[model samples]
Target: MRLNPLGDFIDDDTFALLQQHRLFDAKSVRDFQIRKTYREMRKKMTASDALDKLQELHPYLQYDTIRKIVYMSKAS
Candidate 1:
């Protein structure tokens, strides 16, 4: 479980295993990428601006929904 440059949590072998077992979690991977992108954006702009930019990238999600996803605990 090292994080790759692309923010993937599992190594290729583990990813392959998970895929083979049909246990790969697409939603969790998407959330992780969203959080990673948000953190990187925060370093260059205000939180509000970052959220707005993220919202632009994901028009299906509301601002508050992105806010919750950005701030949500890892255990969730």
Candidate 2:
């Protein structure tokens, strides 16, 4: 019932509703998590360090790719 397993960005009921309507975008959710993680990491380190750690966690993503994702505007 929980579409957002990474965090509670939406309530379970809302998530379930979105799932039922097939309105959930897993990629968007993932990107949101990535941004959230980067923000949290930034609190403890420099921007470059945060991006470095993010890249380490997601080795499949290039440093520039992670940088783009982390710095991307929410309106996108």
Candidate 3:
């Protein structure tokens, strides 16, 4: 059940220091990617279809998370 075990994608020294001090949540990167994927899939398919596709791509993601991403506000 490990996520982002390699640390945040940003390798810069300042970002690394922030991560070391627990000033940020690296998991947000995964959230952002999942949200981005859902948005892209929504463009070519229905909400349910998009959810299914995202599940197929990232089976490790919880079902509720996928559902939330698919149904979240686009303006956010």
Candidate 4:
């Protein structure tokens, strides 16, 4: 069985909101926002540049998380 990476972190309210929006439960809204940022950054910049820009925009997120999202989007 596949396990949701965000399962441990998602709260009841978040899950309800996701259900209402027909969004996948695997990622939270914040996670989706970060991924969206990564995707936008990947469009005009190198992965490193994208990661740097995303980190600058969201200093609270860890570097590795931004890097992973940027790289994964590249792979797709």
Task: Please report the candidate that would top TM-score against the real structure.
Answer: 2
Q: lDDT tens string, model 3, 7-50?
A: 34555676667867998776765667778777787789998888
Mind giving the per-residue lDDT tens digits that candidate 2 earns over 1-76? 3345644566777777887898978777777788988989888999999998998898998899888888887774
The alpha-carbon deviation from the true structure for residue 76 of candidate 3, after best TM-score superposition, in angstroms, is 11
Residue 24 lDDT (model 1): 58
Off by over 4 Å in 4: 1-27, 69-76
TM-score of each: 0.74, 0.74, 0.58, 0.51
Better of 2 and 4 by lDDT: 2
Best by lDDT: 2
In candidate 1, position 59 carries an lDDT of: 95
Off by over 4 Å in 1: 1-8
Error of 3 at 56 (Å): 1.1
Which portions of model 2 show Cα errors greater than 4 Å? 1-7
- The lDDT of each candidate is 0.80, 0.81, 0.72, 0.68
lDDT of 2 at 72: 86
The local distance difference test score of model 2 is 0.81
Kindly provide the TM-score of model 2 when superposed on the true structure, using C-alpha atoms.
0.74
